[model samples]
Target chain A: MNSMKGKPMNHKKFEQMILTPEALTSEEREELARHIATCESCRKLSLQWQKASRMLNKPLPMAAPAPGFSARFAHSIEKRKEAEQQKQVRRFITILLVSLLSAALIFAVTYYSTNSLETIIKDTANASAQMLFLWESLKAIISTVTGFLPTVLLIPFLLTAASAMLTLTLLWLVSIWKLTLQKETVL
Target chain B: MEHELQQWLDEAMQGKEESFCRLVDHYQNGVYNLCYRMLGNRHEAEDAAQESFWRAYRNLHRYDPSRSFQTWLLSIASHYCIDQQRKRRMTLIAIDEPFEETFGSNSPTPEHVYSNNEQSSQMEELINTLKPTDRAALVLRYWHQMSEKEIADTLSLSVSAVKSRLFRARKELAEKMETRREEYELHERETYEPQKI
Candidate 1:
């Protein structure tokens, strides 16, 4: 059926309106009623929707779990808690073993690579001298940098810069940790 | 009652097992109903409901207090059932097969057959034919009386998507029900033809 404006009433639009007639504007509903009054197909669809809507309104039978459901659920919760605890213990043990093995591997590689105690002592002395030279260079560089700025201003600036750098570093590390954890979960 | 549930939720969050159990006792039926409707079977529904609860318990910290807890639980159940349905479709089961299969060749008893035929309404049977997401949308919309926005939130779809799917689901269901009604009438006439003679 065509509306008074001569446009055919689309079945799809009418079906949608039948499903949710309350959504229709009053004018659209009046037009729909006029069309349904004349259109046999749309009227049949409208009745079918009414029956379907009634079917939807009927009470659905509620299904309950078998007896002992709550008890079984509580038991499952307990089992989960135990499993999580066991997992934590296993993780701690694994971490401890890994740390000890890593320390042993480092010690073995260091002791075997160095020739003897005398060589080890010589290497330690050379390392200490290098550190002392590095400290002297750092002191010289600091004196040079202080030439243009007051010590008070320089200290606060360095502290602020250090804090900002630390914060950025922490944030980067956190992001990487989160990314890796996410990857593990996805895998 | 909602405030009571919120109080129980708070206690459960505090590691009180009894409070959690009370919450379970209260919402178990709702969760089970959603699962059974989505899965169309009892055993799978039970497993899915249990799994949903387990997941919810483990991820309780992620539950936002501002939203409805029932919706959160139903979302988990719907997602699990939808995933299972996807896996089930991957295996390619025939549409005409009985809802459940036992190991033996024994046929279903007469009582089982009758009850099975009677329990599934034409609407629900037609609904079972829909895609998992669409089925979830219709169930949440009609059975649960959820608004379109809530259905969208639960199904992780947009509101317009939910509206469109609901419209499509109802249309499809109406078409299927009409076909079934005609088939039933034809069968009745065929059975009555011999008696008429």
Candidate 2:
């Protein structure tokens, strides 16, 4: 070992080197060794660290879980799957009930607005025709605007919009799929 | 064994309960040991191991087959234990509790058993003083024999972070050990000096 005769020792640097032995070069390690030989506190720290490292690294027998661990895990998975199916059934029933109540409420409001069932049917048909007419009118306006735009700009614009819509739809589907997976796992 | 494990993994991914249970049986010791070391208690370790398996089962589809299955399983256990440790920060559990229940019945003598338990408890106490991620890093390094890169991947940290954590953890453990030794020596001196007088 090289003696630390002429040089002033930085205990902090040596301590850090001692802590991270793997990070040290061979020369640095030798320097640390020499420092430890002379410095009492550093020597004590080094000894304690070696003891601690040995305790940490000692290979104790692996601790096994209690017997029937696999069986218990299987049972829990079964219980979870059954509970998930029940939850899905409950959610479906709730959605069905809500839809039915909404339909009933709409029927009551429509019947109250139009005294006769025949008038209600006629009014509904008229509203459908009016919506179709408005959709056609909007299409006509879009076609007129498209005609006014240059083809170069129009093609790129349409492509961008289509791609954007497709990307948004994909993102929405992926999020829903992820949420379903997460819910199942959590359950 | 690798081929058999792969076969079981494939079937488990197909949702075969028996295959998954087989996989569980093969890895339960490793998973449980990691949990026990990380959580510093058998009960919590057992629960954490079960939870980790459950998670791995649910996320089987997400598991990349190219990686080592043991590493993936241990990664799950380590993360779960880290979260448990974080939640348990407010509650102080006794880390120095003797693990007599975990000791095998084949020990040679009571003295040997006592020595082992004392050493193991002292080590556990030193390990338990670390922060959760650092503890995970140290456990993976020492107990699981995981490389720094593997520990980084397991803990979702960079290799440098894992290195720093390991270094810091070792320093802290050394300091704690030194303090405990000083206290022990002081106590012995006090008791011995008074008796002599």
Candidate 3:
């Protein structure tokens, strides 16, 4: 237990010492041998440490990497390199296209912003109106599809409502998606 | 610095398949052995080792050359094992089959070698029951035979902390072994004793 409290030994040197297969220097080894002639506990601990140093002697089974692991690993690395190259090329192309598109967008918006705000609003309003009249559009669709029975007309209105809801939802989702894609302007 | 290694890394980074393959050729076994010791199985160890190398290749540019390359690579594999153990929430893996202790007899064969294996299995089972940290301490100290200072660096603990952890681990293992020995003794006594007539 005192070993627990004691500061770490010259453990850095111990690794080196083990590699040399001699526990101590010539003089130190002679002294240790002399001591071990009489000192029982030190002798035993020394033997134990010496035995532990023979770690590789026990010869833990380490198989060579399975046959053809090298070839397969090489193939996998090639695939990885190919994939990485593709990714880089795609990235460069994307960056190039994006820069071009961004330059075009910047030019268009800068030039057109003053005049286009009104036009943009008008376009949005038209889009929203189409959204707002979804029920009417769906009703037209339903009537076109199921046009015979008066009774069918009543049930057909329910179908129209569902269709209208789905269409509006989809339109709303698409608008959100498009908005996210657009770069934000501080102003 | 091996100029060859540098060339390989440079070419691989430039997306040369041949150079990258050469890199894999160089380090596969070392990675596999480290993983095998930490993971203690073939299939799982192979996967972790393979993943470690791939991760190393993927992040090759980020590698700092100031440190030992093998050490850096091992650090990656070490973290992978830690994350894996955390995910599984177990110190030892659960093989689909019952405990299969593969290896040869220490003593002469057919001299009830199964008994010796049972003893080793019992010890391993007790070790598995220990806290993961404690088990790591025991394994590094006794199994891998790393010095306390070496373990401190490997596990990123202070030397004193490594000592304390190892002491506790040995104490726990000893206690468990004692209990098992007592149980074995009692079982043997019951089985061998003739009923008083």
Candidate scoring better on TM-score of 1 and 2: 2
lDDT of each: 0.74, 0.79, 0.60
On residues B1-197, what C-alpha lDDT tens digit does candidate 3 reach at each position?
48998888779778676787677777776666556555556777678877787888788788776755666676677668767767878765543333333344454464545664455445556666666566665555654556777667666679888777765555455445556667878987887786542
Q: For residues A1-187, what per-residue lDDT tens digits would candidate 3 score against the true structure? A: 1122355334323323323333367876665565555545444445544533333234333334565666776657667767876686677557655755665466446435544476567656776887668768767876776665576356445545555555556556556435534533322
Docking class of 2: acceptable
Q: TM-score of predicted model 2?
A: 0.68
Ranking by TM-score: 2, 1, 3
How would you class the docking of model 1?
Answer: incorrect
**lDDT per residue, candidate 2, A1-187, as tens digits?**
2235667667778878888787789999888887787888888879889988777766675777889888888889978776876686677557655755665566556454534566457656875786688669757866887988886577556545545544554454455445545654676
**What are the chain B TM-scores of all models?**
0.80, 0.87, 0.62
Q: Model 1 segments beyond 4 Å from truth?
A: A1-9, A38-41, A81-187, B90-120, B185-197
TM-scores of chain A, one for each prediction: 0.40, 0.40, 0.36
| Cα lDDT tens digits for candidate 1, A46-158 | 87777677677655455567666667788899788778866866775576557556654654464446345675576567757866886697678667877887865885555
Between prediction 2 and prediction 3, the one with superior DockQ is 2
How many residue pairs collide in each prediction?
Answer: 0, 0, 0
Tell me how far the alpha carbon of residue B97 in candidate 2 is from the true structure, in angstroms, after superposition.
Answer: 4.6
